[model samples]
Target chain A: MQRATLNRMTPYAFMAPAAIVMVIALLYPLLYMVWGSFRDWNPAQTIGETEFVGFKNYITLFYDPAFRESLSVTLRFAVIVVSVEMVIGVGLALLLDRNIRGMSVLRTLFILPMMIAPVVVGLMWRYMYHPTVGTFNRWLKSIGLEGVDWLGQNALMSVIIADIWQWTPFIFILALAALQSLPRSALEAARIDGATPWQQIWHIKIPLMMPVLIVTCLLRLIDAFKVLEVILVMTEGGPGLSTEILALRISRTATEFRELGVAAAMSNYLLILLLILTAAMFAYTKIQEAREARIRAAAEEDM
Target chain B: MPTIRLDNLVKRYGAVEVLHGIDLSMEENEFTVLVGPSGCGKSTTLRMIAGLETVSDGEIYINDKPVSHLEPKERDLAMVFQDYALYPHMNVAKNMSFALRLERRPKAEIDQKVREVAEVLGLTPYLHRKPGELSGGQRQRVAMGRALTRDSATFLFDEPLSNLDAKLRGQMRAELALMRQRVHKNMIYVTHDQIEAMTLADRIVVMHGGYIQQQGTPEELFKRPVNKFVAGFLGTPPMNFLDADIVERDGTVWVTGKGFELALDGEHADAVRAHRAKQITVGIRPSDLSFDPDAANENSFELRVIVSEYIGAQSVLMCDCGGQQVVVELKSETPIPLGETLRFSVNPAGVHLFDKESENAI
Candidate 1:
């Protein structure tokens, strides 16, 4: 009996370090933020010295038009960026999934943007989007075309373009991997079954790749919501509140406005939105796995 | 149905050539089976006919029209893959009607056609189930059902039944033969099993090393093979080969080997006399040798039985004639004494001779 008990305890002993790390690093900070969101807290005092004001910060953010504007901007940016990136990424994957000379080198070049740091990407795009001395304006002037204001009036679009430029390769690499792993014999059978190239892609390839594509799309959506560094470096929320995303707004509320409780409340809202998305993603994968398991069981029973 | 012709077809991958010049003409509504070992280019030949592979140096003609440059869709051919290749996302009905749907046929027509094919394949009960939910045999039937709904000019099969279990393979082979009788279109099938070739093919084209060894009716190839490879490849238990020399003694020609001497008569004797080479390879099928006690030395072999495999109704006996191995198939109740010498007479008509140097039938 004692030997069996010791064997059972061995696995828990091995997992103790990770559990301790999770409680201190993750659970503690999360509880602290949730506690702070209900109080009138500031940077001048400790958490115990601040007075509790239930739902005041949340109520203020509910009616704040500036907060509402930032939320809408974040939503629009995420939706448009994810949709456009998915289309272009999957399109490029389909076009380039073939054997040719120097194809490996070309694929490596296509994914280079995804490997660079986000800060460097932001600085690089900022220089290229300069009004007069930028690459875009210089090329426009050389082609006898008028130069447009990039960062002054069109700051939101400029930041969105930069984010897309840095992130499209993430989707492209995944889509290409999915495309390459498709059944070769099935594609050959499609060709023999009188399907043209375009029909083959539309009917067979797209439907077969739907699972991987859905997961990739959800992951990109999640990342798009929390995006801050590139836009902060490029636009700095300038040209008024046009380019102020939720993450940028939350940071400004805590630092510039000196309202830590309101910032914590805003952070809770973002966290709630992300939690819903993460739950949806998790539920989708669980359902898919259950279906696959049922299918496997049915197949085995037939055998 | 349109007749397909491959005129001097060849396939090359970079610097290496896999298939040499191949010239074959398949008749309209004929079931031609390209049977060979793996890497023998049979599948490559079928893929070329299906327009899946590019023609390297020759022209493919369908009903006397050059079609090498045409796309697979334009060629109007349907194919069944070895793994069945059923779409995992689609149900049986959807998979069967994919071609018709792509062509934008009427919805009612597509539904009717799908129902008809599904009923014929006995897949009507599983019409709404995805391929992953079905058994291997059901998936195979769905693959065939998909091809049948196309109504193409030609049908290509690339080792369709090879992935099934042994018993299932036999059952599916019989079903394929039955289906072949009801639906007569230009069909080209590729497989490595000679039994499948013999049972289903109207004309069997045997290949070796990327070249066609022989093409003929089953009876013709079995009775008179053009080369030693065909003789050994097509039959069960395979043909036994022995080194021998032709000798003339007292106006009678006989092939004398290490432990046996067989007399040749009629055309065989004449062919042996006319041949310049004295040494040749003697070929004999296991079924041609029968256990006999009072046979002459010129017509029988004294073999030491080594192992006897008791299969119901028939038993295969492995024996040693001199130093070479010989397999004999006979009734299981033949009461043979294992570990002892037995005299088995050879049927004169079943004798085959090949040139030792070229391995060609003489």
Candidate 2:
């Protein structure tokens, strides 16, 4: 009986180190943030010294137009960046999924942007988007055209473009992998079945790649919401609150505004939004698996 | 139905040529099967006809019009793939009507065509089920249904029944034969299995090493194969080859081997006398050997039975003549003890002789 009990405990014994690490590295900080959100906390004072203010910070953030604007900006950025990236990335994948010479080199070149550090990407784009000395402005001048404002009035668009530039390859690589793994014979059959190239892509390739594309979109959306470094480095929420995303707002609130409690409250709101998205992603996969299981069951019943 | 012709078609991957100049034509409503071992370029030829593979040289003509540069859609053909290749996202009905929908046909017409084909393929009950929700046989039927709804002049099949289990394959093969009779169109089928080729093909083109070895009716290919490869490839249990020498003994010509000597029939004797080659290979089918105790010594082989495999009505016995292996298919009811020397007489009409050097039928 004791040996059986020990065998049952073996799995838990193996899991103890990971559980401890999770509690220390993840659970503790989350609980501390939740605990801090209710109180009027400062960076200098200990948690116990701060007076509890119970939903004051949450109420303030909820009503703040600046906070609302930042939230809207983050949503807009994520939606635009993700949609454009998905289209261009999936299109590139479809175009490049072939056995042409030097394709491996081209594929590697496409993914080069994703390999660069976000700070470096930000600095690179910042220089390229410069008013007079920048690549785009100089090229425009050389072409005898007026230089357009990339960062001044169109700061949000500029930041969104930078994010898209660095992240499109992530989607491209995944879409290419999914496209490559699709049934080759089915595509050949579709060709014989009187589908042109565009029709095949629209009807066969896109529908079959929907699952992987959906998952990639959600993952990119999650990453998009928490994006701060590049935008912060490039725009710095300058000229107004145009490019001030929620993550940048949360950081600026805690460090510059000296409002730790409000930052914690904002973090909780972001966490809630991300939690919903993560739950949706998980649910999507679960529903897909259930559907496949049901299909297998139905097929087996026929047999 | 439009007749399809491949005029000296060639396929090359870089410098390595996989399909040599292949010149063949199919009659309207004819079921031509390209059958061979794997990597023999049968599938490549079918794909070239379907316009999925580019023609390296020569031209493909459909209805006497050059179609080499035409797209698969423009070529007016439908194909059923080996893996069924049913779209996992679409239901059986949707898959069947995909071509019609792409053509922007009337919705009612598409639905009617899909329903008719579905019913014919017995896939009406599973019309709303996706490919993932169907069994292998049902998926195969859906694939066939998809091709049938297209109403293309030519239909290409790349080993369509190969992915099914043995029992299911036989069932599907019978259904296919039934369907073939119902839907008379120009069809080109590719398979590595000779049995499928023999059963379904009106004309079977046997390929070897990217070259067309022989093309004829199944009876002609089976009875009088042009070469040794086709003889050994087409039949079940395969033809047994033995090294032998042709010599004139008295007035009769005899093919003398290690453990047996067979007197050539009248027709074979004339060929043997006219032929300059002294050494030849003797070919005999397992079914041609029968136990004959009172047969002449020259006509019978005293083979030592090594293994007797009991397969229901027929027991295929593996026998040894000298050092070479010779198989005999006999009724299981025949009491043949193992390791015993038995005199099995060769049917004179079933005898096949090939030149040893060229391996060509003499």
Best by lDDT: 2
Estimate, for each residue in A58-128, the C-alpha lDDT of model 2 and write its tens digit: 99999999999999999999999999999999999999999999999999999999999999999999999
- In each prediction, how many residue pairs overlap at the backbone (N, C-alpha, C within less than 3 A)? 0, 0
All candidates: TM-score: 0.95, 0.96
**Top-TM-score candidate index:** 2
Judge candidate 2 against the unseen true structure and give its global Cα lDDT, from 0 to 1: 0.92
Pairs that collide, model 1: none
Give all candidates' CA lDDT scores.
Answer: 0.90, 0.92
What's the true lDDT of residue A96 in model 1? 93
lDDT (Cα, tens digit) per residue for candidate 2, span B197-291: 99999999999999999999999999999889999999989999999998898889999989889999899999888986799999999999998
lDDT of 2 at A89: 99
Report the lDDT of model 2 for residue B83: 90
Chain B TM-score in each of the candidates: 0.98, 0.99
- lDDT tens per residue, model 1, A75-193: 88998899989999999999999998999999999899999989898899889999988999999999999897898898888988888888888999999999999999888888877
